[model samples]
Target chain A: MARPSDTKTRIQAVARELFMEQGVQNTSLKQISDRLGITKPALYYHFESREALVRSILQPLLDDLDTFTATLAPGDARRLLEDCFELMWRHREVLVMLLHDPGTMLGLDLVERVWEWRKRLTALLLGPSPSAAARIHATVAIGGMSDCVVEHASLPFEEVRAAAVAAALAALQS
Target chain B: MARPSDTKTRIQAVARELFMEQGVQNTSLKQISDRLGITKPALYYHFESREALVRSILQPLLDDLDTFTATLAPGDARRLLEDCFELMWRHREVLVMLLHDPGTMLGLDLVERVWEWRKRLTALLLGPSPSAAARIHATVAIGGMSDCVVEHASLPFEEVRAAAVAAALAALQS
Candidate 1:
C-alpha cells in the first residue's frame, strides 16, 4: 500500500526488517542502504541519521494510533480498547524493541512518544475522575496488552490475543 | 535480622542499591565497596566481579521463590497464586529493575530463573492438558499480579494491590 516516491516509507520498511533480523543496536545505516540497493548518500538524503530514521519509522505508527483514538465513540469503550490493542499487537516488534532498550537516546525518544500516547489514551479511558480501582484497571489494561505479547511470544498468536483481551476486560470490571 | 558473617547478605543489599540507583552498566565494584565502607579487596573476597555479585544477590530471591513454589498446596490454587503475587509485590524493586533493563547479563540470568519459575508454576496451575481458554485465564492470572505493581506504580500500593486481586479473581471466573 506504500507508494514508491515515499522514500521514507521504503527506508523504514527496510530498516524494520534489519532491526527485526539483527536487532536495532546491531543494524547499521550502511547495511540498510546496501540491503535497499541504494547508495549511502541516497539513504542520507532521506534520513540525516539513524536516530532520525527510527523516529520517522515510529511517528506514523503513533500518529495512526492518535487518529484512531481521536475517532473513538465514547459509548463503545470496550471496542475502542480492543481496536487500540489490535493496532499495538500489529506493531509488536517496534513496541518490544522500544521497551527493552529504553536507555538509548533514540529508544528513550521513542518511549516518550509511546508514553505520551499512553497518557492520552489512559486519560480518555479512565477520564479525569476515575476511581482508584478504575485507575488501576486502566493502567493494567493498557500495560498488559503489549506486555502479554512480548513475554508470551512462544504461545500461539490467538492465545496471546485472547489472554490480553481477557486481562483487559477483567481489569475493567475490577 | 542481618548478622555480621552475613557476607552474602551484605553484598546483595549493596549491589541492589547500587544497581538500582546507577544502573547495572554504570555501577562499579569499587563504588559498591566504597559505599559499603569495605575495601575493594574485602569485597573481592566475597564476589569476584559485579556479574558474580548480581548472581549472588539473585540466588536467595530465587531460592525463596523455589521454596514457596515447592510448598504450594496445589489443591488450594487460588490462595497459592495470591501468596505468590504478594511475594512478587513485596520485592517489586528487583522486578522493576530487571524489567527496565533486561539486556544485562545479570538481567538475562534473572529472566531465565524467573522463566523457570513460571514454567513450574504454569504447569502446576494449568497442568499439561488445559484448554485454550483455560490456558488464557491461567496466563493472565499469573501475569496480572506483577503487571499491576510494575506497570501501575503511579497508583497507590493498596489501590493497585486490591485492583490486581480483583482482576485476578475475575479472570479465574472468566
Candidate 2:
C-alpha cells in the first residue's frame, strides 16, 4: 500500500485532473475514488469532503504565494511581476478553473484570497500609493499574464513565460 | 400602452438590469415582466425565452464588435485595442456577469463567440502571422484591460480607459 502522504498526494493529483477535464461541479468524490481504485471511505479519510479537497489543493499555492510576497523587497517590481506570472503559469489549470467556472469557488474563500493577493501584488509593483493610472496598469498587466498563459496551453512553456513576463512588465511600466 | 418596439426595448433593458443584479440564472422571465409592469404574455411576445433574451442582449454587442473590427485599417493596432477596451467598458456590467457567473452562459453560445472575437482581435493587432511572443503579448494586453476595468468598478471611467489603452499598447509593443 502507498504511504498515507503519497495517497493524499495521489488523490489531489487525480482530483485536479478530473476537475480540469470535467469541471469541479461535475466531478465527485466517487469519481475521484473510482479513478484511483480506492474506496470512497479511503478518499474521505484523506479529504473529508469535496470542499476539503479543493482547499488542500489550493492551500499550498496560496501559502507559496504568501511566502513569495514576503521575500519581495519594496522595489523589485519587474522580478516580482515575473515571479507572479511564473506562479500562475505553473498552476494554469487551477487558475483557469477559477477564472472560467465561478461555481468552482462558490463556497470557498479562495476568491477573496486571490483578490487580496492581487492587491498586494499591485502595491508591490507600483508602491504603496500608486496613481490611478499605475494601479490600472498593474491590474491589466496581471490580467494579461493569466489570460495569455491559460489561453495558450499548447505553446512552449518557456516562450509563453518569457512573453507573458515581458508583456506584464510593459503593461506595468506603461 | 408603449409601441411594440419600445416594449421590446424596455424588456431587454429590464432583463439586463435583473441579470446584472441577481445573475442570469436567478432572473426569470416572469420576474422581468413583473418588474416592467407587463404581463408574462407581453414579455414572452418580446422575448420567446430567457435564453432568447440573453442572446438579444449579447447580439448587439457582438455586432458592434464586428463593425468596430471591420473599421480597423491594417496598422490601426492601437486604435483597435482602444475601441475594444471602450466596447468592453460600455458593457461592463454584462461583462462582469459573464466573468463572475459561469452559469450565466451555460447553453448559450456566448463563450465561443467571445473566444472567436478575441482571436480575431489578436490577429488584427498582431497581423495575420504574429510570432508566438506577439500573440502572448496581445492576449495579455487585452486581459489586463478587462481585469482592470471590471475590478475597479468605482474608478473614473476616463482614467481607466486611458490607462488600459496605454497599457495594452505597451504590452503589444514590448
Candidate number achieving the greatest DockQ relative to the actual structure: 2
lDDT of model number 2: 0.79
Q: Which candidate has the highest lDDT of all?
A: 2
Q: Cα deviation in Å at residue B63, candidate 2?
A: 3.4
* Predicted candidate 1 versus true structure: per-residue lDDT over B9-125, tens digit per residue: 787788898776545555678898888888788887877876777766556667776777577656556665677677788777776655545555334455566777777776777
lDDT of 1 at B158: 66
Candidate 2 Cα outliers beyond 4 Å, as residue runs: A5-11, A26-46, B3-50, B69-72, B101-106
DockQ of each: 0.34, 0.56
Query: After TM-score superposition, what is the CA distance of residue B115 in candidate 2 from its true location, in Å?
Result: 3.0
Model 1: pairs clashing at backbone N, Cα or C within 3 Å = none
Clashing pairs in 2: A140-B144, A144-B140
> Quality of candidate 1's docking, in CAPRI categories?
acceptable
- Residue-wise C-alpha lDDT for candidate 2, range A1-174, written one tens digit per residue: 555568889999999898776566557789999999998999878878778888887776777667765665666777787778778877788876666556555576666767767777777777779888888888888888888877888898888888888988988888
- Candidate 2 lDDT, B94-138, residue by residue in tens: 787677556555576666667777878888787789888988888
